[model samples]
Target: MRLGLIKLDHQQVSLAISKLDERAGEWALKCSTSVDLAFPTWESLKSQSLQAFSPPNQAYRVRSRFLSTRQGCLTCLRQSM
Candidate 1:
């Protein structure tokens, strides 16, 4: 089950987990960011990266992958820079 979902602005987003407290069982969370790698540099690349990911499994761990444009997205917004 999902706990919380909040969206800010300009690709700013946050997520929260609840319910399954620390007493329920073992749970692990992971976050990943993907960027374009067309340019000489992965960030400078004037392209978008689309990747495939697998779902979280209880037998292994729970991980979430998202983009992070909060830090000004400077690195990713360079484009032709």
Candidate 2:
């Protein structure tokens, strides 16, 4: 299945789309943002990204206080997808 990967580092967050290789138990990165996101831009990016990167019947793993702030967004995104 395809997976959304959100990586949080000090003052920035990185987003990536990956495909999980069930047989190999590995994740292969498909695409990612070139720019790292700070708090000021995280919201817009998160919404736009979730919509664009998230497809139906897939999973996500977001790691960051920034993303965590909007739990409903994540849940809704999952259900919508």
Clashes of each: 1, 0
Candidate 2 C-alpha error for residue 69, in Å = 27
Off by over 4 Å in 1: 1-5, 8-15, 22-25, 29-81
- In terms of lDDT, model 1 sits at 0.26
Root-mean-square deviation of candidate 1? 18.9
Superposed by TM-score, candidate 1 places the C-alpha of residue 38 at a distance from the truth, in angstroms, of 26
Q: Model 2 residue 27 lDDT?
A: 19
Best by lDDT: 2
Tens digits of per-residue lDDT for model 1, 1-81: 232232332121112222224522122122223211122332222121212123335224422212223245454334325
Every model's TM-score: 0.14, 0.23
What's model 1's lDDT at 65?
18
Question: What is the alpha-carbon lDDT of model 2 when measured against the actual structure?
Answer: 0.38
* Cα lDDT tens digits for candidate 2, 1-81: 112243343223232222224431121222233333222354544565556547643444443333445455475335556
Clashing pairs in 1: 39-45
Task: List the lowest-lDDT window of 10 residues for candidate 2.
Answer: 23-32
lDDT of each: 0.26, 0.38
